[model samples]
Target: MDDIVKQALAKWPNVPHCTGWLLLDRRGNWRMRDEAAQAAGAPGEPIRHTALLGFINRNYEADDAGQWFFQNGPQRVYVELGYTPFVVRLAANDPSGQLTLTDQADAAFEPSAVYLDDEGGILFTNRSTPARVAVLHDHDLDLFSEHADLASDGRGGEFRWRDGAVLKLEPVRKSEVEKRFAFVASPAAYAATNPDNASR
Candidate 1:
């Protein structure tokens, strides 16, 4: 968390929280949802400000209820997830020609497991106690395809990085992803059942 944000929280300890006003899309875009967009179930406009994006990335966190949010100074702006909480892209500048991954937050990702979803999305998870699941950017599918060794059925395979690290690919159901990964996909709806965690 940012020091300024921490000071704001200390100064105003009970600021209201917000929900359904921000979204993290599947492609890793940060979207700002207005009232009309929220009512119409739209993804809203993508936020392109580099400084704002960096701020959100720095303060992004998840609550014990599996709700992810950005600590915007004093208020907690809950994020609506389009898919997984994180989206990863194949790193472009690795000198060894090995497959490397970086998350939307621009942090290096080392996967302990790899999965291919029913919809053909590539997902990666690490060995953390409560693992984070990140989907590979669709645009980088071709690059990933070159490194993956798939079965004749393309149902299962192995990903071989040029650096000699290998990961076995497994099958995953899209519907079961949230439960399997222990992440709440729609935190607004989740809060409906646990109203205490809802916006103030």
Candidate 2:
């Protein structure tokens, strides 16, 4: 296993349950493993896409200061978990509304606002468009907004002010692209273990 993968796995064991857990190889080609495949009816493929690549792409970001961000697309989706061993529950619109619990570690990166719904999912504005709100169905926004210095706009849902400004809005559903991009583990895993190489 690559050192980064080892570190990420050690840091976030829940990774195995996320949409995908990919390793960036020394050459820059992405190596992905789909955890959903472990169960029945799960897609059978490894997520390989040069465009969908980044250390903080699908993985959480943590700085030495102990703050973290749950990256979604181009935005660093924040969650609020008071102290170490941050725990939160998540459930998506699909999948029968089953809730999945996640435990995060405290690590800082950039300061941003994160919102949570009663169901424990995350809510945020589009990175390119602040006016357009997005709800990450199966995520924990409360964990990222716990200590947020900013206050919500008094709407039932959490809010952030001018966090991610609006530019243009285009939405893509995960299920729509699941087959076009997702893949299963392969021998490529050997060469695509380093983030730099994974990009190639």
Candidate 3:
């Protein structure tokens, strides 16, 4: 076991009842098995397994989740939890820890790279721009009332639940014709090409 994992184990002797836990590398590669095993206690025979990523993705379910990606020198450790948002307990070696919570109110949107509030609300950026933010009006019963359901399509694609509705997010890429002339010419180049143009 690594020093960080050991430290986490020591601090949280009894891991909270969560759907799944994932350990990933800096390159987003799965490092450990994705399973919610008993923390050396609590249930029947321990399910000894490997490939943590596969286990969690296959077995458990999650709605509001959090992930902590730690970097120290060459070692990169990523800890992710599915189902319930983890209660962050700061340790001595912890440089930075991140937590994210997504529920029924915010299921249709994508998360931004911003610090979350103490109550798990998404924080806003100082620089104003056209962006979407999902605010939880009723924190107590929002998630329970607007639970998302997971459904598998006849094909390999999976459907995600949003706002008490099943929404399919099929990956679609722009065509090559649509992607042409996408790069904007530099101002200097444009001026050189059109010297007489007044809009310099």
**Highest lDDT scorer:** 1
Q: In what order do the candidates fall by TM-score, top score first?
A: 1, 2, 3
Model 1 RMSD, rounded to 1 decimal: 1.5
- Which candidate, 1 or 3, would have the higher TM-score against the true structure? 1
What is the number of backbone collisions in each predicted candidate, taken in the order shown?
A: 0, 39, 5
Highest TM-score: give the candidate number.
Answer: 1
What is the lDDT for 89 in model 1? 95
Ordered from best to worst lDDT, the candidate numbers read 1, 2, 3
- Compared with the true structure, all predictions reach lDDT values of 0.90, 0.32, 0.28
Query: Residue-wise lDDT of candidate 1 within 79-189, one digit each (tens)?
Result: 999999999998546575766788998898889899999999999997677888999999999988888888888888998864678899998999999989888888878
Local accuracy of candidate 3 as per-residue lDDT tens digits, 109-154 = 3333222233333221112233322222233224322332222432
Candidate 1 vs candidate 2, TM-score winner: 1
Off by over 4 Å in 3: 1-68, 80-200
Q: Which stretches of candidate 2 lie over 4 Å from their true place?
A: 1-44, 49-115, 127-143, 148-200
